[model samples]
Target: MELTCFKAYDIRGELGTELNTDIAYRIGRAFATFLKPKKVVVGWDVRETSPELKDAFAQGVLDFGADVIDLGLCGTEEVYFGTKFLNADGGCMVTASHNPINYNGMKMVRDEAKPISRDTGLADIRKMAETETYSEKAATPGTLTQLDNRAAYVEHLMGYIEFETLKPMKIVVNAGNGAAGPSLDAIEAALKEKGAPIEFIKINHEPDGTFPNGIPNPLLHEQQPVTGKAVKEYGADLGVAWDGDFDRCFLWDEDANFIEGYYIVGLLAEAFLVKQPGAKIVYDPRLTWNTQEIVEANGGEAIQSVSGHAFIKEKMRAEDAVYGGEMSAHHYFKDFAYADSGMIPWLLVVDLLSRKQTTLKTLVEQRMAMYPSPGEINSKVADADEAMARVYDAYKGDAIAEDRVDGLSLEFADWRFNLRKSNTEPVIRLNVETRGDKDLMDEKTQDLLALIRQ
Candidate 1:
C-alpha cells in the first residue's frame, strides 16, 4: 500500500484502511532506516489501537537494530521529555490528537527532541517506508525497556511555577477521558506534597480509549459547555480542558466564560515577560495586535512566526524566545525545548494568578476589549487559492500593508485580516481584528465573508 499517512508536519489518517499495524511496522523500520539512531523512545495515547500499533512500531525499530524505550501510555509531551530527559537518539508518539475515533497517527522527533516534519525528514521516511524491503539480515537484535516517566514529567512541569506561591483555590480539570488525567493527578499530588493549598475538581478523569465523553477537542463550541458547566457548578476558580493527546489546552474563566485562544497568547506572553524583562516572545501571525501590544508593553520584543508547531519551535529556538503561542491553543516554551506543551500552559497561567493575586478575568478582560477579534472563521470554497486571490484583489489597494508571510495578510488603518488556506483541509480561514472597535470588526468581518463566500 502507498504511504498516505504523511502530512506537512505529521502523520495522520483513518485507521485500518489508511493506517494499521503493518503500515506502522513499516513506518517504524523506515524511521529507523532513515534516522539510524541507536536508541528510540516510543509512546502512545490511550486509544484502543494505540498499543498494538506502538508494539508494531517498536518491533520495527528493533528489527532495524535499535533499542526501544517503551513509554507505554502517555501524552505526546512525555515522549518529547523522555527523548530529551533520557538522552535518547529519537522518539515517536502514536496519537491522532483530537481527530475522530476512526483516525490515528504518529508524531516523531530526532535527537535533542527536534521535530521531523515533511521538509526536514518525514518525506524521506515516507519514501523509504514505501520502497524499502525488509530481510532477515545478520544484525544485533535490539532490546526493549518499559519506563514510567510520570515523576520526571511532573517535576518538569512544576519547574515552571513555584508551588508555595500558589494560593488556595478550587479549580476544575476536565481530562475528557484522554491521557491527561494521570498527569493532572500526579501534579495535584506534587503540589500537596509541597504544601500548596490548591484543590482540584476532576471530571472525566478516567482514561478510556473509547472516548465515552466524545473526543477531548475543546475547539468545538459544544465541548466547551461540559467543562464550563462543571466549573460554574463546582464554584471553581478556573477550568482547563485538553484534547486527546493533551498537546493543546483550552481554558475557561472563574465565571465559566470560555476564553478564546487568541487572548491566551497575550496572557501567557505577559506572564512570561513580567518575570523575564527584555525577553523575546514569539507569536503566530494569525492573531497579532493583542500579543504584540502586551509583549512590547512589558519590556519585551514581539516576533511573529508562521503557524504550526514545527515553524513556531524553529523560530523560538532561532530567536531564543521565552514563549510562543498559537491561536489554536498550542503554547511553546523556550525552556521546554521550544516545543508546545498543553500541560505547561495552564501551570503558567495558574502561577500568574497566584503571583498577581488576581482573577483570570481581571488579567484578560481589558486586553480583550482593547483589541476585539472575531476569532477565526472558515468557509469552504471551490478553490482555496482562488478565494484568497479574490480577497487580495478586493482589499490590496486599500490595505496599508500586505504580506504573504504564511498566506495573504492585509492591514488597514482601522482593521486588518489574514486569509490562509488550511494546512490539513481544503478551506479558507479568515481572521479580522480592529483597533479596539468591536462594531468595526464585526462589519469588516461580515463584509469579507460576503466576498470570500461568493
Candidate 2:
C-alpha cells in the first residue's frame, strides 16, 4: 500500500507518479463511506490536473450513492463556502497550493467546512485508499450538477466586512497566476457597486495553469520579492499575493517590505477584537509573544494551540474564537464556518487600514518594532531529531521554561526560541523572537543555528 500521499492535513503528491485518477477515485469512495454524506461539494484550482481529479473523485462519490455539486475552477475557500452555504455533507478542493506545476493534491472538509486532518480522519482515508477494497456492489450512483457559486461566495464574504466608510486607496495585487484573479475581480466589482473608493492595481491577474510568471508561493523568499517589487514600483498603498489555490495570502508594505504573518496575526486579532471586544482569538504556540500582548491589550482572550490548521480550527470552534491565526500565514475566522480563508484576512486588513486613514506600514510599524523576529529559518540536516535534541540539551540549563508541545520551545527572560522538525521534510524549522531587540534576536538565532549545524 502506497501511503506517501497521506500528508499531514490532506492527500497530495505528483499527479501521475503518486496521485492519479485511480487514487483520487478510491479516496473519494473512502471519504463517502467514512463520512456517509448524502451529497458532496467539490471545487478545484486552475491547475491542469484539477478538473481531472475532481471528476475522478466525484465519480467515486457517486459510485457510493452520494451526489456531488461541482464548483468548477474556484479557490479553496469557495469550496468551503459552497460546503457550508450550500449545505453539503462534505467538500473537497483539488489544489497543489503553491507547489510546483507537476504537483497536485486534495483538501477535504467534513460537513460545514470542518477540516479532515490526520488526527481526525485523514489517516483512515489513507488506509482505505491504500487497501483498494472499494464497495463491490454498484448502487444507484448519484448525479453531478454544475453550480457557479462565485457570485454567492463573494457576496457572502463581503457581507462580513463593511466598506461603506472606507476611503480611496490604491492597492497592489499580485495574483502570481493563481486563482485569486477572478475572485479579486468579483471583490472589485462589489466594492465598485457600493461606490467604495478601493482601487486595485492588478498584476499577474490572469489565471493560467502553466504559471508563465512563476509558482504562486509567497511563502518562499524568492517568490515574495515579486509582490514587494510591485508594491514599490506601483507606489500602491500595499500589496497582497496569494498561493496557487488562494488559501493563504502574503502582504507587502508601502516600502515593498514583506510583512511577517506574525505581525498580521496581531493586526487582524486587534481588528476583530475591536469590533467584538472580549472575543476569543486563537493562535499557535510557535510564535505568540506579540499576539498574546495584542490580544490581551485589546480586552480579548488569547488561546494558544498546537501548530497546524486542524488544531487551530478545532480550538476556534471549541472556544468560539472570533479569529485564529498561524505564523505560517493561515488565518481562520468564525464567520467562515471556523475555517481558514486566504481572502478574508487581507480584505479585513485593507478595510481596517482604509477606515483608519493610515498605511499598512504605519499601522504595523510599532508592532513590528516591538517584536522583532528572526524570521523562520529552515536548515536541512542529516538528523533533525539529533539536532533538536542538541538544542534542547544546550538550552536546558539557561532556559526559564521549556515546552515540547509542537516542537522544542525554550523561554528565557528577554527571548524565546522554537526548534521543531518538519513533518513533511528532513529539515527542522527554527523561529526566534526577542523583546524588540534586533541584536539579541540575531545573536540567539545565530547561536541556535550554530548548534544545529554542529
Candidate 3:
C-alpha cells in the first residue's frame, strides 16, 4: 500500500524515489487489468528516466496480454490524440510536463481519449498498483509494436487551419529543450512542403531532457523575457513556447509583449465564434469579464467551468462546447476530443491573423483595453484557507456579486478578483481585472497581496 506517485488527475513523483521502474511495471499491469483494454498506446517525454520507465510499463501491459503501441519520445497530447486516432482501447503518457526535471509523471486516457482521473478509475488503479494484486498474466502474452505518430499527428494539427489562404508570418518557437521540438519541426516541414506562407524562427529547438537552456515553462515571469527577447530579435510576427511536454504553449505579441493566457481565451473564443456562431465556449472562473464579453458579443454562450484539464474536458463534453480554455494556457477543442493542445491555439491564432489581415496585437488590443487583467498571481501562505477567508471578509461588503464556482470570486462595480488555492501546491492564486482601469487593477492586486500576506 505504499503508493506516493498517484495523484488526483495523474501520477507524478520524483525519480528513483517515489517512482522507479518496478513501480512503473506494476502500474502498467494494474492499468491493463483494470481497463482490460485490448490495445494500449504508450508514449514518454524526453526525461532521462522516461525511456526505461516507459519500457517497464509496456512490459507490464504485455504481461496482461494487452497489445502495446509504443509511441516514442513525444508530447503528452500525442498520447491523447493517438488513443483516438488509432482507435486504441487506452493510452498513457510518461511525462512530468512543466515540473522540475527530477520529477516524472503519467497521464492516462480511456476509450475515445476520455481522461482517466482519480474519480474516474485512477483511484482504483492506484490501489491495484499499490497492492500488486493484478490478475494473472494472460496465457499468451500480448503483442508489442512501435509507431511513428508524428506524421499523422502533424496532419491532424494542420487540419485546423486553411493553409492555402494563410499569409506569410514569422513565428518564433522556443521549445525549451523539451519534446515539443520534433512536433514543431514536423508541422513546419509539412507547411513548407505545401508551400504555405509561413516562416519559423526556432530557438532552443532541440529536445534535451537536461534542459540546456532551462525548463520550458513560459508562465514564469522570469521565463517570459526569453520568448519576448526572441520575438524582438527575430522581428517575428508572433512568438510561441511550450512546456516540458509541450501540452501547453505560451505566447508573445509582435511587440514582444507577453499576452496573458486569459486574453488568449477571449481571442480564441472570438475566432471560433466567427466560424461557428452560437457555439458554447467554456472558460474558467479565475478571470471572466473579457471571456464573457467576447463570447456574448460573438453570439456564443459562455459557460464557466472549474479549472484543470479533467474538469474542463468533462464540462466540454457535457455542454457540447465548441471550445474550452483555462487562463493557465490549456485550450480544449471539441474537434480535438475535448483535450487541450499547445499546438492548436497558435495555429488558430495564425489563421485568425490571416483571415483578419491584422496583427495579433490588433486582435487582442481592444479586448485587453476593454478589460485589463493583471493575470493570475500566486502567493505562498502559512494557511491558504485562513488567507482566503480574511480576503473574503474584507471585500464582501463592497462587492456587488460573488461566486465560489471554482474559488472565491468577488465582483465590484468596476473591478473583480478571484482568489483560489492551488490544488497541487500550497499557494493561493489571485487574479484582478477591471473595466479599462489599469491603475485599479494594479492597486487592487497589490492590496489583495498585502491582505493575503497579513
Writing each residue's lDDT as its tens digit, candidate 2 over 251-315 gives 99889989999999999999998899999999987888999999999999999899998998889
The candidate that wins on lDDT is 3
Score each candidate by Cα lDDT: 0.90, 0.89, 0.92
Global Cα lDDT for candidate 2: 0.89
| C-alpha root-mean-square deviation, each candidate | 1.2, 1.2, 1.1
TM-scores of the models, in the order given = 0.98, 0.98, 0.98
Predicted structure 2: clash tally: 0
Worst 10 residues of 1 by lDDT: 132-141
Give stretches of model 1 more than 4 Å off.
Answer: 133-138
Ranking by lDDT: 3, 1, 2
Candidate with more favorable, higher lDDT: 1 or 2: 1
Model 3 regions lying over 4 Å from their true place: none
Encode model 3's per-residue lDDT on 1-454: one tens digit a residue.
Answer: 5888998899999988889999999999999999998999999999999999999999999999999999899998899899999999999999998889899989989998999998999999989999998989899999999999889888889888987679999999999989999898899999999888899998899889898877778888898899999899989999999999888988899999999899999989998999999999999999999999889999999999998899999999999999999999999999888899999999999999998899989888888988998788889999999999999999999999989999999999999999999877789999899999999889998999999999
**Local accuracy of candidate 1 as per-residue lDDT tens digits, 18-90:** 8999999989998888888889999999889999999998999999888999988899998998999999999
